[model samples]
Target: MNEPQAIAGVPLRWVGPLRIGGNVATAEVEVPLATYETPLWPSVGRGAKISMLVERGIVATLVDERMTRSVLVTAGDAQTAYLAALEVDARLDELREVVRACGRFTELIGFRHEVTGNLLFLRFEFSTGDASGHNMATLAADALLTRILETIPGISYGSISGNYCTDKKATAINGILGRGKNVVTEILVPREVVRDVLHTSARAIAELNVRKNLIGTLLAGGIRSANAHYANMLLGFYLATGQDAANIIEGSQGVTVAEDRDGDLYFSCTLPNLIVGTVGNGKGLDFVEENLRRLGCREAREPGENARRLAVVAAATVLCGELSLLAAQTNPGELMRAHVQLERKNATTKLGG
Candidate 1:
């Protein structure tokens, strides 16, 4: 497949190209950085400018990685639930062994139990190698459940997924326990860069974040999240990279924080439920494979490392888009004008062709 051309007047650069995660033998992957111009009035084009800064190493991003999955098991009665909990704790070592035996890279991290009168729900968390671990977690949960039933008795099979895993929905659980790759992407934009490039001050941006993202979201009844349009960039990137786009529902649940550090802007996006993986379903398509290969996620020493790298890149891209859109909002009429101009240009070009 051909390499991606420039978009939104921003040049594309391959950033990082660095060796990430465990093991030194894995191939070094570079994330593709492109300029993105927001559709807003006044048209600041902060997206493209932020891309340039990321490519030039002016902004630093750190990735906290994990490949997690949760499974739910229900018990018939409270007494049964209590007994099952005791057995589960007693066989923790054996359960880990069962998980290891089931897959080379699957590890049982931890488990939680909740009881509502007679019903008991157990959520098992796992670290599946290189994969998003949805399927892996389910399979491991099945085996473990079977073992528990045989040993404990009086407990019936609840479901492969009890919704306690909280797959595609926005909930407080995923934010607290964390699903997929929990990534926090931040950039420290210089005071001069903020004014000249972003066309706004750090204080303006921070105050807007407080008023719009935090307070506005609270007033609007946002559930455990305060961010503007995280799904925009995430959906585009996920589609290009072969991720399950529906995961964007929970993936969009994140917080955008802007701080005025002296005169500079410290902007970050914390995405807790970014369910992404390098190798899994939908990743085998030719275009998807090409994208992963280009992004340096196709090769890694371990199973989960590549997925972690992909998560970091995805988070960083979201941050760039968020910064651009927020900056555009700082100027009156800029957002709507840019949209009209860009959309009209596209329509005109199409009609001309």
Candidate 2:
């Protein structure tokens, strides 16, 4: 085994454990937020007039989602693929109950199948409560595969991940079917707030989004998203909270919208594939657990609720940072000027030390 490399740690900045509510019976909750140390974030916060709300069942759908692993059998040809597909279809009710027995709050959402040459590809989707459902979906897939092998004649193992389920990497399927929390964050900045705080106008911000995020992204062949630098905020938040930072790949896929409604600027961000969880994997670490506790995520009424709460707050933070950056870009040299100023201050502090 190769030895681990020693590296200096990056600075971490905690922003808000700000209180926000959802459109549900659950009480308002606090979500602690942080960013990997960056001079830019403080500028973003100065003009943000943000609001957040969580939608429950939609986020819960992340847990209830399913994954299917298909196999090829010696006795199976294209005809066998058809027959096996029918057999699996006929036993949908039985298969769902089988999956439910594997875990609490598990539900089979649906399944699909295809035949390429003689290979049979079957995919299943489920809802796993409170968890991101990666391992849980795998376990259910394994058990479901066993049932297929036992019941369907001549069927042998193929691969557990058919890539039909589509994890990690960005794809159209997750955007359409909906994955993780569907958090929508909105901000309304009065024209005065825009000019005074952000140093730009509502019309300018709205036009910039259309030109840069929408038309510009299209010209560049961007995939199912239209936003600038969502990954910047999300990566920082994930690292500080002990989340699987890699999920930032899908997590960063989102859209930013701005309208010069009347005179005030209206801005919003919709993140559909934010795969995050609070009670598993990295949560046991000292700092991660402490952060969760401070955010009020560790004390939710149920296992999955805390994760949902975290997701909304996360979406809100993304909006705050995005709005600030776009506003800064409206002026010719504002972006680089801010960077130079912040970095110079940082260097001076280090020299004094």
Model 1 spans with C-alpha error above 4 angstroms: 1-45, 51-76
Per-prediction TM-score to the true structure, in the order listed: 0.85, 0.84
Any idea how many clashes model 1 has?
9
The numbered model that scores best in lDDT is: 1
Residues 194-300 of candidate 1 have per-residue lDDT tens digits of 88878889999999999999999999998779998888777667776777878998899999999999998888888988888887787876767887888767764
Please report the TM-score between candidate 1 and the true structure. 0.85
RMSD of 1: 5.7
Put down candidate 2 lDDT per residue, 1-353, tens digits, no spaces. 56438522556666632334444223333333455345545754542333222122111112222332333333358888878888999999999988898898667778778777677877777766666777777888888888988988866788777766667777776666666666766666677777877888999999999999999989998778999888888887787677788888878888999999887888878788787777667677777888777766777466567777667667766777788899888999988888888888787888994
Give the Cα error of residue 25 in candidate 1, in Å.
14
Residue clash pairs of candidate 1: 40-334, 40-335, 40-338, 41-333, 41-334, 41-335, 42-334, 130-303, 130-304
